[model samples]
Target: MAGGIFVVPLLTLFAGASFPTAVAVSLVSVIACSCASAPQFLSARLVNLRLAAVLELATVAGSVVGVLLVGSIAPGILYGLFAVVLLVSAAQMLRPRRSAQPLGSGWGERLRLASSAPDAGGVDQRYHVGSLPIGLSLMFGAGTLSALLGIGSGVLKIPAMDAALRLPLKVSSATANLMIGVTATGTAAAYLILGKVDLVLAGPVVLGSVLGAVLGARAMVRVNGSVLRVAFVLVLAALAVPMGLTAFGIEIGPLR
Candidate 1:
C-alpha cells in the first residue's frame, strides 16, 4: 500500500523522479510490500483465497488494458487521473458502511466466498460475501488503476470490498494486501520491458517498503476497525493534495 500509494507521489514530487520511473519503482515496491505482509495476514486467517481468485480474473484483465494505454496517455492526464482516484477512494471510505450480514442466497453461497476471521476479542466472526458481479466490476477498475498509477489498487479494493461486497474492513485490507502482488507482477514486467525501471532508485524504495510493511502488518491486527477506517480516509485525503496540484503542473517541493 505504501509503495503503490505513497511511494509514487513522494518520488515524483519530492525526489524529482519522472512519473514513469516513479511508477516503475512503485510497482516493484508493491511486490515487496505485499510479499512481506502476506504471510502474517494469511497466518491470521484474514485473506479470502476463493474471492481473491475470482476477483483477480477481472483485475488482471484490466491491468493489461491499463498497460496498453500508458504510452498513449499524457503525463498531465495521468496525474489528474491519479488525483481523481485518491479523492474518490477517500470519499468512499468516509461513507457509512453497509450491513455485512449475509444475504443467505447470493454469490457467497454459490461460489463459497464466505469465511470467518478472529475479531479483536479473538472471536471467529463469520462474514458473508455478496454482489459478486459488482465486486468484479470494481476490481476491474481497481486493476486498471493499479497498472496506470502503480498504487497496488488496495485503496480502491478495500472500499469496493466494503461497499459492494459487504466485507469487513480488516478482511478487505488483509485480502487486498494478498492480491496486490499478483496484480502488480505483469504490470511491472511490462514496465521493465519498456525500460522504465530504475534499479538504482527501486532498490532502496523496495527495501524501505518491505521493512515498513512488516511493521505495519504487525500493528494492523491491534488497531480498532473504526479507527483504521478513519485513518485510511485521512491518509488518502492528505496524499491527494500534492497529486491534485501536480495535475495542474504545480510542484510542492519534495513531500518528504
Candidate 2:
C-alpha cells in the first residue's frame, strides 16, 4: 500500500529524467500491479467487463489528450494539481464508510455503466451503474494527472468508484487495477515513439515491482485484510504530505 502511494511522487522528484523514463516506470507498476491482482479478481469473478470497457475507452481517449499536453505544461503547475489530487485521495481513504445502507439498486438500474459481479467470497453482489457521468469525468482527471506525473490513476479512480458511484471496495479496487494498465499502454506508446524509454534504467524497477506484486497478491489470498484498510489509509496520508510539499516547492529530499 505504501508502495502504491509513494512510488510515483518519489520518482517524479528523483526522475523526470525524461518523459519516457517516468512513463516506463508507471507502465511497469501498472502491469505488475494489475497482473498480480488479476487472478484473484478473475477467480473471485469480481470484474465488471462492461463497466471496465466503458471506462477504458474514456481513459484511453483522455490519455491521448493528456500526454500530448505534457510537453507544453510546466512541471510545478502539474505537480501542484497532483498534490491536490493526492490530498483528496488521502482524505477519501481516511473517511469512514457506512456499509449498512443497502448499496442501492444493481448496476442495471442505477447508472448506465454499472455491472454485476461475484465477489471474492463467491457471492453474487449487484453493483449499480453509479454516477456514470461523474465517474467518466473523474477518469479524465485521472488520465490527465497520469500523463503529467507518469503514475497510474488508480488512486483517483478507486475512491471515486467507492464514494460517488457506490461500488463495493473490492470491485472498485479490482476494476481500477484493470484500468491502469490500459491507460499506461496508451501513453507508453507515445513515449516510446518520442524516444523517451530507457530500457536499462527501467529494467530493475520493473523486475523488482513485478516480483514483489506477485508475492503480495499471493499473500493477499491467505491474509485477512480487515485491518489492512486502515494501514493502507495511513500509507496514503503519509505519501500525500511529501508529494504535496514538494509540488508546492517546499523542498523534500530526493528519496526516489
Candidate 3:
C-alpha cells in the first residue's frame, strides 16, 4: 500500500530533496513502481481495469491542472497539504470499508466495475463499486496532489478506492498501483520538459522503486488485507510528522 508514495518521504527525509523536487522525482519512481508491479497484480486478478479506466479520466485531467499550478504553490503550504493528506489517509484506512450498494443496484454493474478479490483463505469475496461521483471528485484532487506532491497520488487513490468506491483493500491497493503509473506519466513528463526532474537523484530512486515493487508484489497476495491497511497508515502517519514540522520552519534533514 506504500506504493510510490514511499519514495517521496525517503527523498525528502534522507536525500536532501525539497518537497516539490522530491515530488517530481517521486513521479518517475511511481511509474517505475507501477510498471514493475503490473504483471503480478494483473495475474493475481486484483486489478479492476474497468474502474481504473473510468477513474483515470479524472486523475489525468487533474494532473494537467497540477502541473500548471506547481510553480505557484509555496513550499510551506505544500508541507501542510502533505501533512493533511497523510493524516486523513491514515485515518480513513483505519476503518474497514465495504460497498454498501447492492449488486442489483446496477450502478457499477452498468459500468462493469463490480468485481471480486481473493481473501486470505483463498476465497473470492465479491464487491461492488459505489459513489463513483465521489470517487471521481477525490481522484481529481488526488491527481493534482500527485503532480504537486509527487507521491503518485496512491496516498489518496487507495483511500478513494476503498472509501468512496467501496473496493476491498487488496483490490484497492492493486488497482491503485495499476493506475498510478498512468497518473504519474503526464505530470512526470511535464516536469521533465520543464527541467524540474533531477536525473542524478532520480536514477537511484527508480532502481529502488523497481526492486521494492517486485518484492512487494510478491508479498501482497500472502498478506492479510487488514495488515496491509494498518501498515500504510503507520507509514503515512509517521511521514506526516516530519512534513508538518517542516511546514512550520523546522528541519530534521537537509533542505534544498
Candidate 4:
C-alpha cells in the first residue's frame, strides 16, 4: 500500500529510473503485494466482494484514462500532484470515523452493500453502507492516481470506504487489499504494452512486496483497527513531506 509513495521516489532519485518506469514497477509490485494478501483476507471473510466489484468498474475505467494522460504531464507536476494526494489522504485518515447508520433505500441497499462480519471479540457486527455515489467518485480518483503515480491506491480506497461508505476499518482495509491487484492490473497492462516496465527491477520488488504483504496481512489480524489507522496516517505524512519537497525541485537523499 505504502510502496508507491516511497518506491517511486527512491527509484527516481537513486536508481536513475524515469518517472514512467518507476511507476510501472510500482504498479507491478502493488499487484504482487495485493495478490499475496488478498487470499488470506478472503478466507477470513473480511473482503466485501460485492462492494469491491462495484467500485472496481469505476476504478478500472479511471486507470485507463490516467495512463493515457501520464505521457502528457511533466514529471515535476506529477510529483506535486502525488504529494497533494498523500496529504489529502492523511487528512482523511485522521478524521474521526462516523457511526454507521441504517441502510436507506438507494443504490447502497439496491446493491445489497450492508453486511455482517466477526469482530475481534468474535461477535458478529453489522455495518450499513452509505453514499455509494461518493465512494464511487473517490474510487475513480484513486484509480487515476494509482496509474499516474504507480501506487496501489489503498490510501485513497481505505478512507473512501471507511469515511464515505461507512464500512468498518478492517473491512475497508481488507477489501482495499483485495481490489488493488485488479486495479493495478488495469494500468499495468498499459505499461507493459508500452514497454515501460523494467523486468529486472520489477522482479525483486515484486518478490519483496509479496513477502511484506503476507506479513502485513497476518499482523492486521492482531492489531487494533484504530492503531492501524494511526500508523497509516503517520506513514502517509512521512512520505508526503519528502514528496512535497521534491515537487519544488528540492532533492532529498535516497530513502534506501
After TM-score superposition, the amount by which residue 201's alpha carbon in candidate 2 deviates from its true location, in angstroms, is 2.2
Ranked by TM-score, the better of candidates 3 and 4 is 4
The TM-score between candidate 2 and the true structure equals 0.81
- lDDT score, residue 132, model 2? 66
The sequence of per-residue lDDT tens digits that candidate 4 reaches over residues 1-256 is 6467667766776687877889999999888888898888888888889989999988888798887888899888998888887887778767777666546438988999888877878788888788889899989988898889988787678778877798887788888887888888977887798787999999988888888889988886677878887987887788777777877988786542
What TM-score do all the candidates reach, one by one?
0.90, 0.81, 0.87, 0.90
Clashes of each: 2, 5, 0, 0
27, model 2: CA deviation in Å? 3.0
1 versus 3: better TM-score goes to? 1
Q: Candidate 4 — which residues are off by over 4 angstroms? A: 223-235, 253-256
**Alpha-carbon shift of residue 241 in model 2 (angstroms):** 3.6
Lowest summed lDDT window (length 10), candidate 3: 98-107
Candidate 4 colliding pairs: none
lDDT of 2 by residue, 1-256 (tens): 2143355665666664433365556665666667766776767667776778877777778788887887787666666666776677666666775333233445335445545677566777665656666778788777776766667776668756775567777677677777777777777676667667677766776767777677776777677665766676676666667666766678665544
Better candidate number, 2 or 4, judged by TM-score:
4
Q: Compared with the true structure, what per-residue lDDT tens digits does model 3 show for residues 181-224?
A: 88889988878998989999989888988999899788866779
